[model samples]
Target: MTTTPFSVGTFADGDAPPFPGIVVDGRVHDTRAVLPAAASTAALLTDWDAALTALQSFADAPAGAGIPVGDVRVLAPVQPPGQLFAAGANYREHVIQITVAHRIGAAGASEAELRQQAERELDERAAHGEPFVWTGVSTSISGPYDDVILPDVGEDFDWELELGVVIGKVTRNVSAEEALDSVAGYTICNDISTRSLIGRPDVPMMGADWLRAKNQPTFFPTGPYLVPARFVPDPLNLDITLRLNGETMQKGSTGDMIFTPAALISYLSCHVILHPGDMIITGSPAGNGSHYGRFLQPGDVMDCEITGLGTQRNHCRTTEH
Candidate 1:
């Protein structure tokens, strides 16, 4: 059993401004309204267990005592995190799919033999290679239900639904066993991408430019809820699903990730000190838009959800010229 229940965002109605909220038995308890001390979700995340303990009174209240769930406009549970890290190519299946898509031959002369050889190399890489992680600017983040404006210059607008790990404490050089202890909660993050912009022809020597390829405004739509880590026992087993206009586009599981959240955290902590409210999004599962030849366009709606984390629905709108 967990101390803190699922957390939600605040807003009396869809049109209202967002506030901090905690969901208890279908009711929304404003964290600020219930306990004057919790000013923001980010503040509570600094010491989530203690915050929950302090607000135990509200958690114990009757079902209907707080605001109705439907009445609240659920925003991103936390403010823009202090640091944002996005793991790249951390899913084994996703990496294999990319290799197959590009038709890069492997260790043999024949196609069938080449595939077998490729699989072996992939297995070896998974066993020994380190996770590829990238940094993302916080300004790219937007509310869960906000409109995602499609950049006019880029045609292939894609989505990568991932499990976002929220850091609860300052951690550095932690072991994999201790890494999970620092997690405050889990949230759904859509790591939106512009496929065409990934290539930098002139700066090929500089390698991939993630900044221009990924840092567009509203590129990351995160959180309808932040399911406290205590409530979610296994972050790696969650089923990740994303729907586009009622059709399922991406469906996979966190179990497929090559690098576990704990390993990623431990590796990241070795390089940089992770602080409370820092967000590290585990790599997306195999079914991104690039795989299906389906990309976002005006009027497209993306409804994405993980096993326990709440869902997010964002409408795609064309950028104003």
Candidate 2:
């Protein structure tokens, strides 16, 4: 793909319902109108290289082809990827934060000692550990600007803004040396969490309960754009910023990822085949709501951004029981 702004979305004109659109600047160019074959974002992903070529041609066409991105509702970038792969504790600082909490209950570990152990573990994991990959249901996805319906009980709802990687090709056991070739692009993903519900108390030894805590409706607010790989010169260097109610809550960078995008792809592919449109959202950085005890509440707004990919603003609401 060239340096063309390649963002695919679903938008409707005057309540006519939504259609796949290629977002260029502030305007939305219809993908179905321009190229019938590449009608939906999923369809476009099936052959990303060709779809990108078609998009490039349309982008260079005469100015009268698209309409302004007015008040049309912007749906999730596409249907949820065929598989959603999320990395856990992939950032060095994130490990530190998680470690501090986990070891806080340890009998004799000092705070400094806990932090040191966490840092050391990060280095060892990056050098020899396989990436920890988890699966998420696609139903959790909502529009980029959609309202997040918080559960009525879990009071520790938090925000974790991370970069989402969109796979473009069929890849199996691909080497890290050539993993970038399989990536289609990147997007912004907020892995909203009900922190208190992560563990299963009844099944004392089963470990994390990802499905219950992370798969609630509107739990994952994804994408205002799908920035093609070519546009993001270095995925590891982008800045990630997220604010709650206009107050900066999470501020970090992809550079801190203990498992880089390539590493995660290579390690993950060694086990399962990655299909086109599969997403691997690299883990969130430190400074989550847990850090400051500033968990999300109804009426609070979250503004998340990942460099050139774009920003997403979501409001929090709780439906009456």
In lDDT terms, which candidate is top? 2
Compute the lDDT of residue 301 as modeled in candidate 2: 96
Q: Evaluated with TM-score, which candidate comes out highest?
A: 2
TM-score of each: 0.92, 0.94
Q: Give the C-alpha miss distance for residue 208 in model 2, angstroms.
A: 1.0
For model 1, the superposed segments whose C-alpha errors exceed 4 Å read 1-4, 10-17, 62-64, 107-115
lDDT of candidate 2 at residue 58, scale 0 to 100: 74
Worst 10 residues of 1 by lDDT: 106-115
105-182 per-residue lDDT for model 1 (tens digits): 753346455556667877886789788899999888887898998887766989998999989888999998999999
RMSD in angstroms, all models? 2.3, 1.9
lDDT of 2 by residue, 1-321 (tens): 445555777777886857788877678877877679765788888988998888877776634647777667787786645789899888888889878877853579998899988878778888888888888888888888999999875669989999999899999999999999999889999999898889788997999988888889999899887778878899999999998888888899999998899989998899999999888999999989888878888899999999998889999999862
